[model samples]
Target: MVIRYSFDSLQPRPIDLPTEVPLDDEADLSVLDEAKILAAPASRADVERWRDQIERWREEARSRLCYSGAQYDRIESQWAQTCFAVAQVWLWDELLYSFEDHVFTPQKFLADARQRLGGLDAVVLWHAYPVIGLDDRNQWDYYRQIPGLKELIAQFHAAGVRVGVDYNPWDTQTRRGKADVEELAALVADLGADAVFLDTLKTAEPELVEALERAKPGIVLEGESRVLLARIEDHGASWAQFFADSPVPGVLKSHFFERRHMLHHVRRWHRDHSEEIQSAWVNGVGLMMWEVVFGVWVGWNKRDRSTAARMLTLQRSLSHFLLEGQFTPLVECADNADDKLVFGSSWKRGTDTLYALVNRSEIPITLKPIREETGIVQLDLMTGAVAQHLAITIPARGIAAVMTSQGEINPDMIELASEVSAIELSDDARFEHRRVHRVHESSRSKNTGESGVLIEPGEYVLTVRYRGRETGMYDGAPYVDEWKPLVPRLHDPRTLERVTTLDNPVIVAQHEVTNDEFLHFVRESGYQPAVSNRFLLHVKDGVNGRGHEPVCFVSLEDARAYCEWVGGRLPTEDEWQIAGDKQGFQRLEPHVWNWTESEYSDGRSRFAILKGGSDAQYDESEWYFDAGVRPPDFSAKLLLMGLGMSRSERIGFRVAFDRRNK
Candidate 1:
């Protein structure tokens, strides 16, 4: 299917685009207010001091091993499937949150409770396990027996927020009540607790998950540490750190791409500086711990809300791809950040690819558009809106998930030659570890071979005949057939693997205008301080745009002056695109994205167009390569157009000499 985007004329023009689609703070889903939700179990042995543990074999049922083929030719597709459960959790400590000063204010506590549970749209609300009393003084044996506790649990349940009590199976002796497997199970069953944060997690054993399920069928059991043992029965998810937004900002890059099911709860995400929260999403982690529990829970402002809303918006859109697709790293920039630039990763489904690009630095970072891709878009995660492709700049500490829309190249479409060689198909299906079921058609050929899906082990190969194209004369003209090869996909699944890392945004400056050139412009026109690049000092590499290489950090004005001194002018956006395309002299496209004379809008501002794309990391769309290719609507020049103004690595003018001068 051809996916086309209809541009909205309402958006800012000549785009310097970064928009935040609004989101509803309160959820329509209400919590269960019925008293039955708070069932006080008789006795529970689990305690805070010592925790119990269990181990188990892997659970096969939790995973769906994909397969494709007919009865005779069954093929097992690659199961890179992940279940991205980026759950927003509200971890609350009842005692600490209940009292204000030395005195107890049940009203204040209740208000806080209402705000955390009703206001926040969290899938799970965590109630710390032990109900240790006010002073070390009041050690409440059970939470259900406490005053008004029943209402809280019921409210949480009514809101569809699963209550997760902290479970410490190891420390059974401290509690005077029955605290064994059965006791803990009964407690979770009664309190409507859907999950237990296993303190001091060892492994996600089947025994632990099974026992929990016995009491509460759909309850989730999270471990303190991230578990790699996908072996546990129902241990599909976990919580990583207390703070989702890392304290030492820029250090904690969330591995949501690799570990999709884990939730890195941002314990310290407060209102004042919410860049961390915004950065967390860009880093690919979902928003968490925005609650009224341990902290003051200051709400976000306009800017922060814009970004936070954007993050949540993306969560709702790409949740599936993150959860289901195998994580093939998109050659994003290295994790190392030196206060300036950063990048992201990508994933694929069939011929289509999607990328997650983010800028974790304080400075804006630009990138070149990736090659062999089309329909590039700077996706708005909030509303799934595709912003202008030309204005693709990841805001400082921000993210943009872009994808490629290309047609798929299938194998059957190609006609192969005869001469069955080393690439032979073993009639006997070896390695019976997996099963396959091809549900499509099976074509046969006499000389070359049969055309159909091959089901086998250890990376199945499609052995087809290949013959060079032959030209023939038809009634009116010469006819030639072009031979295409079966796009060599991965060994198992028919998924495409990208090895060449997505190119970084390009950099260009024709050996920044030399210091001599700058002096010449200054001498003739008296370099006006107000008009000159104020951020000139940023070009520490060169004081007066001297040297053999391009000048670094030259403001737009300086660039223009140096160009005019050299008797040249900045190329228009169209001209720049032509040059980038190599117009009549198309050489390998340069990584240096040169500047254009086009205004971001037709305004007086300096928001000019910058071309060739930034050589930075960028997202690839899953639809980048679809089947059924088409002729270009216009030409390649139209595809290479883009926009950018300030904060480039280096700024140098690309002179478009007049025809007479040329």
Candidate 2:
């Protein structure tokens, strides 16, 4: 049997490119709305035909669907049009949550967003998934259990950044809850979420739509990728993930169909975002900034971040033109030659017209926009100043905008120019890399009792094996700069030969610590976690009969505390691997994964390495964390979270004692 990458289903579906065949007037035009990009005809003679055909299709589709677009006109849903830059923030991102303080720091997150991505118009508090199913806690519990999440949302609202909560329809295996629609509606109402991001669904079922609307009138529903044509009426926005564009720059189908329907272009794993930024600018849509993808760091390059900042500044200021103006895709610049790599779009409303341009080449190119009327004030959007000359030079792989208005320019445009004038266009597009470093356990224990197996200190070469999940074993992004990573390269069983040097002798516990052992430690030491939301949650349900079972529902910190109380420390991943290689290292009955002291952080994301697979595994999907018992060399990366959420019923820990000076 051939195992394919598509089996993992990690990547989005292939983009639907435009058809080159000419369409008859009677052709069903509704099918055209499914295209990722409405490509321009290559021949000049067919340009008019291509444009007319699309217009006719839109008219026909609208008539057939009875499209009123009342959703866009709603005063409540109006925010969707202006929400240009939304950050898909991991709930536990370092900037958002302080692990040390055990608190959610919305101010820090907001400040960073403003500085780097030119201020986010909204943020999707991405919870669950890539970490869910570790235990029975459902998706809603992840959000509702947070201590100050409501206050956090309030802070974001105060900063003018709307909050969006994610809805994962795939979470059917976890602890049962109300119907997804009812739970999602209640969650939205409770948190005052401005939008609900359909994680994997292109559109929510009609039942969900109605429920959410009743929960929060004017609530926006944003689908994951391409939303169906008919569903676009209610879906205020859609995520343009992995959308491949045409060479001549094409129009976004959904945006073209309804100008107010926002589509945020995003390629999560790609470091260089020039293509997405350019697409968003030309289409007058939005961009989704997912710096920390799940638990991996796929941060935006400085060049792209600056480009987004500049693009958004103008987009926000002259949004009136972008939203209400008559739009023309691939407008011809006055001095643009056929050979030039620059492309631009023109948005015209009354006497004012705004031109958004992008240079696809590696060198700056100057272009002159057609001056149809005399005495028009040309404001250089890049510099936020008046254009000294008609010829505007766009930096290599950069974006620019020019607002040409009759008489006086709008105060918003002038303010936008002033805001962006201070921003220096960055030429550096280098990927900002962060290496994941293992955090060594600071608290060590002296070797005393020989209750466990003793391993003589020596360097050992171990063959480590793991399933290549998207969360990456220990460090770096699993897929970088790849359009889409498929099977063989994704979610396949992988092997690595690692030579680990252990200078000091140590004794690794033969079996994981039992529930009774941890209970005694907690009772004797009276250890109380600072933010004890889910600490030792199983204890409340009764750990009495499970005294001999491996202790579960304890975080790495909690495990470390227990091990320290026993005058021992949690073994490092290498130490445990070596011990596992030696016979007699037993897994407790009803096996649970052991937490190694291999916590790592790349600043933005923090994760820990787990060894010795557990019996509890959710085998229904590849997106779930690695499961089933395995060899000592097998390892899994668990993204660490604060507020005791890391504590799981499927995970436990053992101890290692360092040999004291003899």
Candidate 3:
């Protein structure tokens, strides 16, 4: 009687399949013994020879079919299939036995295969069972012997090749359930395998997919060909395969081949069915050459030296074809048979589109007019003479690659302004003209004499003067205190909090007027007023000629409105900082205050005020005040005092000219 089976069923069958036969049962036990003997003390020379042979074969195969597109696809499919079959068979047979006793040496096979292949891109080891030896009671003990496997892996990695392992999560000897599969997948990911070979056993494709997602999310998964193909066909898991032929517009058919024969197949297929394949799969074709010939399998003999060589050659040729234009999908097959084929990676740099072209036919072909807005194009891979116009002819089976140019901005043209000068205030005392004027030289002239010199437009360091109390009375009594403090105490908390120290030497009075600053700019310039009708009355108590009193009381619209009047605009925060004072005061002296263009308090307070003081008050303020006290309120004032003066309430002002105006 025939038995019906669902695709999802995981039940074991009554009979063991031929594919599951033990190595000792099928092959001579002596062959296993010989491998064991040879591998027992495998020499460095033995390993090198195998590596050389593999490299030589690969080089030869790649050179032979460098231009064959069809051959490349066919061999790729074959290689993938071979890897899947070998991996599955190995898992079914030899992995359960201990290499120390069974004489199934994976290292010996790898050394031989390496010599045959010339150079391996990578090696993959398939471990079928969780535990290798029957005598090994602890499962972890079986893994301790993996150091030998790791050595081989390290060798390949040092040679610029990657090494991977096949993880069979369903093996009952190692794992008993779904949870075990998950744990094993996580372990494989943690091992950092270059590639993972997954088998479809008791686990379903969906479960495998989920396991991969949860465990090794970023790692490359090399699925069994039959399992992947069947999943795509029956279970609707198209993403299982790297290349699915269904969704791609014109794909006719796809297959897997060994890497050894891929080059030959690609060339022959390109020659014979290039038109059909190109017509059907216009999105370009994908070829898979899994690592079966890398001497990773213990069940099969190492791949023939010739086979390894052929695979390398095929890979090189395919890479060259991809770089050239031959591999591009025929997006729209024109009626003209001479239409050129395009090839390109799906990567983009910027606005420019990149295209790789090749002439498949014997005759030369010229590409149609490419759009100018596509930007100027340059060939990244060109070695010959360069030209603005791409006029060179691509010979038969030759490639041409081109990418658009990226533009850059000139650094030399950007100009930066100099720092703003610090505001320095003159003494509030009377100005006296003297050739060395002295106070009390004429006791009656004291009220009429000045203490400091006058300031000119270029630059000056002015000092404020204050009166000190006399110690005793005499014809002309000498005072105990010489100079009065710069900052005077103010009764209003808001006014006192705004004062700043004179630490910053340089200060600018006014920020270059934004429309806001110029709105109050009653000063005469030759240009007609942008906003002539709007009148600004000079308030009496307000600091006049002090454009630097942190231009305030202006609306946002008014600030912007004034900028047009002065033929200048508001400074950006960066520009304002550059021009304004940055240094903190050491003492309580008010320097000339400057107006900044920045909006403070979220534009609710439309101005930023800056002040500076001397070093004497630095230690004095903390003794009586907390850190939270607002700095002396010179925010709205135009003048700032020096270190020892008592008139801190009188805020000073200074002026700044826009360099842009000059």
Candidate 4:
């Protein structure tokens, strides 16, 4: 549909959004500490000067046998330390999932990503390296020149996901391996990766991280390094390196009894440190993600999947609060309801606060109100339910959420600003929009504050009329809904609900809720937003800052919270179709797989049907649905199923007012 937008499309309108208080002198996009660029070896001239020494170091590493107790020399220059620091800050944004991803052959991983790992943000490639210990320049060259490796990294980058290659930098594996600063630079230079994950390192000398980043500015450094090491300014992430049973609780939750405390020597002090690990997660600390269904899926059951999902979901949902908010330990490990062990922590960013309570046991647990001085509403992330008191109940082996607001909420009393739209998807839909800031091949091209839009993505009011027309294939061109003699239930709802909203068209919000708008609801309603993977991509300072992108991790209930706050509600599935199916309404913007007030079941699991697809950037149709014999297509009748309570980066909602609700 061709729809043009111009200055005269709508009258002047603006919504006053909350302004951010400076965290430091850093205003917009000035969050990075540029003064400490890590001098000397970080510069190309100095690094090139060490080429001969680096080559000899490589030769020595290649001859070392597995368990030879031989150590390969790495660059110890201060410049190298600067690279490590630079890497840690740049890579902190990634949420790692380490598995021997079988689909990651150099040729196919990127192409199959949309189908197998659509929402995946970080990917680690393992299983291809045959040599465990150090080999010389020839072996290193052969490994670095693996065909199609460059293309895979480039594609992943284009999709906004970083790819990391796994290697044990020291001696400890079935066979010992060796790597140094020069070798690290050579590997990254040829592979085109964003990071290198050095396995089993208690401390990844800052020099190595710095050298890698010097070669690739955005290079991330990660591994099963200690928690404190990951916390360094340039250390990207770590794998549960918190001392095992040493005093401080472990943050990396082991998958089973056999594998505890990452490196075999450090036995974990106790089991089920999920609560403690979560504390680290909120602090923007990275964990080794092996107790997951990442690859092979060996010996995995539903319980294992749910357990991993719970941690990932909590991480994804609370990501904004965890990464950006300052972490405050609210409660230490304690015995709670029915003998279940519980712990609590609060991630506070400005007036917005998300309090997380985790229960580790085989039974349910409950917590009474802690801060009863003022009213607070706890929004359960697992169940899309809300309660007024601070008290909350968590499922067995599960986590729960409760957020406190610093503002008042009066949904029924909402007085919205003008320029709203009430239209179905059409060729001529009107809406307000803004493009997110993009880095043009220059890492220093922009500042952190610039990522947070100064202006809000406003609302546009457009009208949508229903069309109850029947469709069929003509000249081999398949229409939205084709009537088949044998299949009677095809294309039924459009004609059914067309008359429902015909009498009085409702006012609809034009754009998907931006991060800034959702924060308003979170701050005012005391509701928690969905912890989404996408938030990690745009969080400026551990908080959601890419305000121009559509808000994700919102549930139907969360959607209702915003609608109620704005004196509106979600559009019905029929109304949504009518808006998109409209003939001549100029479109305000492309779709992002929105949630409608409609649902269905596939004879087993119940799912909320989502409509519309991502913008052209995604290159996939949103209007796709199939049941049994029906095939995937661009049909408006296509319906996609999503777990009602779970969150998705691609799925969200738009607000609308119903005449009937009045």
Best by TM-score: 2
Task: Report RMSD (Å) for each prediction in the order shown.
Answer: 32.4, 2.4, 34.7, 27.8
lDDT of 4 at 16: 10
The list of candidate 2 runs beyond 4 A from truth reads: 1-28, 384-389, 408-412, 487-489, 540-543
lDDT of 1 by residue, 5-96 (tens): 33322221221121111122342211111010111111122111111110000012122322111211111101101212223332222222
Query: Per-model C-alpha lDDT, please?
Result: 0.35, 0.83, 0.28, 0.38
Candidate 1 Cα outliers beyond 4 Å, as residue runs = 1-140, 147-151, 169-175, 200-207, 228-233, 242-260, 267-285, 290-306, 332-340, 350-352, 368-389, 406-662
What are the models' TM-scores?
A: 0.39, 0.95, 0.28, 0.38
On lDDT, the stronger of 2 and 4 is: 2
What's the ranking of the predictions by TM-score, best on top? 2, 1, 4, 3
**Model 4: lDDT to the true structure:** 0.38
**lDDT score, candidate 3:** 0.28
lDDT-based ranking, best first? 2, 4, 1, 3
Per-residue lDDT of model 2, residues 40-139, tens digit only: 6675556667778878877888898899998888999899899999999888999999888888888998899889889899999998878886777789
Window of ten residues with lowest summed lDDT in model 2: 4-13
Q: Which candidate would rank higher by TM-score, 1 or 2?
A: 2
Best by lDDT: 2
